[model samples]
Target: MSKLGQIGAKLHRGEVSYDFIGHRKLWFGISIALVVISLGGLFARGLALGIEFKGGVEYEAKVKVTDSTVQDFGDAVKATNAKDLGDPVVTTINDEKVRVQTKPLAQADIGTVRAAIAKEAGIPAEQVTSQQIGASWGQQIADKAILALIVFLVLVFGVIWVYFREAKASMAAIIALVHDVTITVGVYALIGFDVTPATVIGVLTILGYSLYDTVVVFDKVRENTRGITGSNRYTYSDATNLAVNQTVVRSINTTVTALLPVGAILVVGTVVLGTGPLKDLSLALFVGIAVGAYSSIFIAPSLLAVFKEREPGMQALNKRVTAKKAQLAAAAAAPVGVATVGAPAGAAARSDVQDTPRKADRATGAAPAPSSRPMKAAAAGRPQPTRKPRSKRGK
Candidate 1:
C-alpha cells in the first residue's frame, strides 16, 4: 500500500489519531476569535451591496481603453450633479466598456447623465445605454433570498435530526453552517466585495457543501460511538476524536479538490475579467468553501462531542474508563517480585481475577456483588506435570 493508504489504515484502526475532541477548547477559542474579528469587520465596514440589492441606475459607455477612462467617466457623471445621483461607481469591463452605477435617478436626470457620459466618451447619447432598477424589486429579491435561507436551514435541521435521531448532532451541524456563513459574509464585508445575486447563490451552495461535509463526519462519529455506553474502552470524546481522525484525510482531500477550480475562477475573474458576476460569485464561493471545510472538521464534531459528553450515560462511561486506565497503570508500575515471605503466591493473582468480573460488569451496566470467598493458597513446592516419552507411549 502507498504511504497515504497505510496512514489511513492506521487511523481507521485507532493506531494513529488526532485529539480534536480532547483539545476542543483550543479549536473553540480559535473559532471564537475569528468570529469576533469577523463581527467587528462586519459592523465597521459593512457590505458593499450591488445595484441588484440596492436599486440604482446603471450606464454602460463604450470607449477606447485608457488608464484615465474610469476617472474621466466618473468625473463626467458626477459633473452632471443631478438630483439623487449620489456617488457614481465607475469600473471597466474587460477594458472595453466603462460601467457606471448611481442611485436611482429621474428620467431627465438619467438623460442628462447619459449625455454627459456620451460627450466625454466622444459617442452619441444613444450609444450609452441606461437601465433604471427599482428599490422595490431589490427588496423583493432580498426577501426571497432570506426566505430561501430560512427554509434551507430548517430543512437541514430536520434532515439531520431525522437521519441521526440525535438532536445534538443536528444542532452542532447547524451551528457550523451558521459559522461558515457568518465568516463568509464578514470576509466579504471586510474586503468590500459586492454583494450581488450571484454572491447569494454562492453562499447557498456553500451551505450545502458545509452540511454535506459535517454529515460525513457525523456519520463516522455515530458509527464509532454505537454501543459506546456498554464499553469502557472509549469515552464519547475518545470515540469522537477517533472519528475525526478517521475522516480528516477524506475531508482535506475533498476540500482541496473543491477549492482548486474555485481558486482558478476567482483568479481569472478578478484578474482577467475585471469586475462582474464571475468575480462576485467566485469570491463568495472561495471564501465560503474554505471556511465551511474548517468549521465542519473543527467546529461541528468538537461541539457534538461536548454535547454528548454531557449525557449521564457518557459521564458514567467516562468515569469507568478513567478508573480502569488508572488501575492498569498502577498495576503496570508495581514492582515485580515484591511478594514478602509467607505471602500466598496466588494472593495478587487472585485479586486481579476477582477484580476482572467486577470491572466487566460495571462496563456493561451490570451490578455484581463482590465475592467474599478466600482464595486457596498455592502449594509451596508443587511438582510440574511431565509429558510421557514418545517411545514408551508407542510401546
Candidate 2:
C-alpha cells in the first residue's frame, strides 16, 4: 500500500493517533495567540471598505495606444485643478481600461475629473464614463450583510445543537467557525484588502463550508463515543482522538480539492485579470477554508474534549478509565505465571460497572448461580432416570 494509504488504515483502526484532546492546552494557547493577533489587526489596521460600501464616485476611460501611462494619469488627477478631489485610486485593466475612484463629488467636479482623465489618457472626452454613488445605499448594504451573518450564525447554532444533542460540541464548532472568519478578515485588514460585497459573500459562503467540515469531525466523535460509559476500554477523550485521526486524512483531502480551484482563481484574478471581484472573492475563500480545515482538526475537537472533561460524570469516568488502564499495565509487567491481585469485585463494580467473576466462585471453586429458567437434564449434565417400563402395565 502507499504510504498515505497505510497511514490512513492505521488511523482507521486506532493504531496511530494524535492526542488532540490530551494536548489541548497547547492547542488552546496557539488558538488564543492567533485570535489575539487577528483581533489586534482588525482594530488597529481596519479594513479598506470598497466603493460599494463606502459610496465613492468611479470613472472608467478607454484609451487607444498612445504615449500615456498610469503614472501620467496619476499626475493628471493630482493636478486636476479641482478643489477637494482628495486622493484618487487608479487601476489599469487589460492595459487599455483605466479606472479611477475618488470621494463623492459634485456634478461639475465629476466633469472636471472626467475631462482630466480623458486628456491624460489621450482619449476622447466621450470615451470617459462617470458614475455617482450614494452613501445611503452602502449603508443599507452594510446593514443587510450584518443581518445576514447574524441569521446565519443563529441557524447554524440551532442546527448543530439539535443534531449533536450536546451543547459543548455545538459551542466548539461555532467557536472554530468564528476562528476561521476572524482570521480571514484579519488577514484582509492587515493587508488592507478592499472589503467589497463580493468579499462579504465569500465570507458567508465559507461559514457554511467551515461548519460542514467541523460537523463531519464532530459526527465521527459522536459515533465513536456512543454509549462510551458502558465500558472502560476507552475514555471519551480517547474516542475523540480516534475520531479525529480517522477523519484527518479525509479532511485534508477535501480541503486540498476545494482549495486548488480557489487558489487558481486568486492567482489568475490577481495576476492575469488584475483587480476584480474574482480576486476579492477568491482571497476570502482561500483564507477562510484553510483556517476552517485547521480549526476542524486541531481546535474544535480539543475544545470539545476540554469542555466535556469538565463535566462531573465525564471526569469520574475518565478517572476510572485511567485507573483501569494502570491496573492492566501493572498486570502485564508482572513475571510470567504470576497472578496479579486486583481490587475486590464490589469495588470494581462500583467504579466501572464492568462484569467480574463472582468472589464466591473464585474462592470455593463452585459453579455460578443458575439461570431463572430450569435446564433440561441432558443440558444440565444430570443423568436421566431409567424409565420404568412397568409403570404403563401397572396403570
Candidate 3:
C-alpha cells in the first residue's frame, strides 16, 4: 500500500491514540457543546414531518407524458378545487414517461382530484392513470418502522454479547449506533427534510450498515486474539489495533460507493433539476451513512478499547504482566524478591486479603475464619499486626 494509506491504517488503530480517557476532562467541554448545539437544532426548528405522518393523500400515476412539453401539473391540481392541494411533485419513471405525486387529499374530493389530473395533462380522464392512498397510511408505516428499529436493536445487542462474550463490546457498539442515529436525526431537523416513509426506510438501511461495520471490526479483533498472552507484542489493545487497521479502509470504500449515486441525486435534484424523490430519502441516507461510518470506525472501536481497558479483570491482567516483567529484572539484579515471591509469580501477592492462621492454614487451604468483628470496622480498619508463635518465628 501507499505510505498515506499505511499511515491512515495506523492512525485508526490507536498507533497514535493517546490516553484519551486520562484526558477525558479535555474533551468533556467539546462533547457537551456538540450535544447542546445538536439539541438546539432539534428543538428550535423541529422535524419537517412528512405527509405520511401528517396524514396526506398520495397519488401514483403513469402519465402518457413526455418531458418535451406538457402543461404544469401544479396548475392542474390548482384547477381541481381539491381542498389543501400541495405542490404536485413530478419525475420520470422510465423512457418517455413521468410520475406526478401530491400530498394526501380528502376522501370526498377523490373524483374532483381525478378530473384535475386529466384536465392538467390534456389526457382523457380514463387515459390518465391514478391511485389514491389515505393519510392514515403514514401511521401504519411509522408503527412498522418503530417495531423494526426495536427488533433490530435487540438482535444486534444479543449478537454482540454472544460474539464477543464481552459486555464492553456490546455497549460500545450500541452507544455508537445511538450517536449515528441521533446525529442523523438532528441533521434532518436542522436541514428541514420532510420526514417521509422514505426517510424511515433510509434510517433502517443505516442501521444495518452501522451494525455490519461494527461487527466486522469486532470479528477481526476476536480472530486476532487467539494467543494474546500479555506479551509486549500481544495484548487486548494490540488485538483492537489490528482490528481497526484492517477495517477502516473497507468501511470508507463501502460508504463511498453507496453514497456516490445518492450524492449525485442530491446535487442534481436540488441544484440542476430542482426536484426529485432524492429530497425525502437520500438526504437522510447521506447524513446517516456518513455518521454511521465515522462512529463505527472511530467512536465505536475507540470506545470498545476504552471500556475493556477499564474492566477490572483486564486491569488486573496488565498489573500481573507488568509485575512479572519487573520481578524478572529484579531477580537478575538482586535475587531476593525473586526467591521470596511465590511459584505462580503474581498469585500469592494478596496485599488486601489477610493470611490464614497457622492451624487454619495447615488444616485447609482456605483463608482464616473471621474474628467476629462488625463488617464496617473490619473493612474500615488498617491492617493489624499479628504475633507469630515462638517456634515458627525462630525457624
Candidate 4:
C-alpha cells in the first residue's frame, strides 16, 4: 500500500470477507434510489426557468439612478402599478448600466411596467432597451438542452470505454457520474432554484470535473494491473481498491478547493447581491461538488470492482485461488506418524510390520533342528480340533 493508501485503510474499515461484489451492490442500490428520488422531485416540482427561457420582457438600461441598486430596481418595478413584475433580474454589467431581465408583460401591461421602472430609477422609458420574448422559445431552449445532454452522455461513455478497454469499467464510471448529476439536480428541483442557461453550463462543468476524478483513480488501477493479466498477485478488485484508497484524499481536497469559490458566490451573490445568474450557478456547483466527490470514491471504484469481477472466467479465478490455498493447508496439517498413501512405478507396497524368518542352521545344514523335539511328540502336544456334531440316528 502507498502512504496515502495506508492512511485510507486506517480510516476506513475494509470488508471482513469476500462476497463477490456484495459491497458494490450496496453502492449501486443506493445510487439507484437517489436517482429515483431525484426524478420524482423533478416530476413533482417543475424547474424554475429564467427570463431567457420563460420568454419574459428584458430591460438593459444604463440609468445613473442615485441610491438605486439592482434590488432598488426590482423593488421599484414591484412597488409601482407593475406590481406583478415576476422577479426582475438586475445585474451590474458595468458601472453605468444595470442590465435587467424579466418575464414578458402583456401589451396593455407593458406601458404601466415601464413607467413604474422609470419612476423608481428616475429615468425616462427611452433610456431602457427592453425586448420581449414569446413563451414558444422556452420549449425550444428545453429541447436543445435535452439534446445536448444526451449527446454529452454518449460522448462521455464512449471516451471512458475507449480509454479503459473494459465495458464494465466504463459503464460503472458513467453510472456514478449520472448518480451525482441526479442528486444535484434533484436538490435543485426540491429547493425550487432557477434553472437558467448558466445553470446548464455549471452542470456541464461539474460533469467534466467528476469524470476527471474518476479517470485519475482509474488510471492508477490500470497502472497497477499492468503485466498482471494472468496471475493472482493483483486481482482486478485489489487494483481498484488500492487505486481508490490512493486517490481518495486527493478527490476530497479538490472538491473542497472548488467549493470555496462556489460557497462565496452563494453568500455574496445571493445574500449580498440578491437573486442573479451567479446565485443560480453557484447553487448548482455547490451541490454538484459534494456529490461528485462522493461518487468518484465510494460509488465509481466499487462499481468497477463489481462489474469487472462479474465475468464467468473472473469468478472461476477467485474460486481456484481459494481452493489452492485450502489444499495446501490440509497437506500441512497431516498427522506426524501418517505416511502419504502411494506406490512407485505401479509396484504394490507393504506395511512396516515384519514377519518371522525361517532359516537353515549353518553347522548342520538343512533339517538340523528337525530332531530338537520329536516331530510326532510335538505334533501330539498340539490340541486336536473338536469333532463335528453326529447325526440324530446312526442311519
Candidate number achieving the greatest lDDT relative to the actual structure: 1
The number of the candidate with the highest TM-score is 1
TM-score of each model, paired residue for residue: 0.79, 0.77, 0.67, 0.75
* Model 4 CA RMSD to the hidden true structure, in angstroms: 14.4
What TM-score does candidate 4 get on C-alpha atoms?
0.75
Q: What global local distance difference test value does model 2 have?
A: 0.83
Clashing residue pairs for model 1:
none
Scored against the true structure, residue 145 in model 1 reaches a CA lDDT of 96
What ranking emerges by lDDT with the best candidate at the front?
1, 2, 4, 3
lDDT of 3 at 326: 87
Give the distance in Å from residue 2's predicted Cα in candidate 2 to where it truly belongs: 2.9
| Cα-based lDDT for every prediction | 0.88, 0.83, 0.69, 0.74
lDDT of 1 by residue, 83-144 (tens): 97776777787768888888888889989999999999899999999898888899899999
Number of backbone collisions per candidate: 0, 0, 3, 4
Please state the error at residue 27 of candidate 3 in Å.
Answer: 7.4
lDDT of 2 at 200: 97
Question: Which has the better TM-score: candidate 2, or candidate 3?
Answer: 2
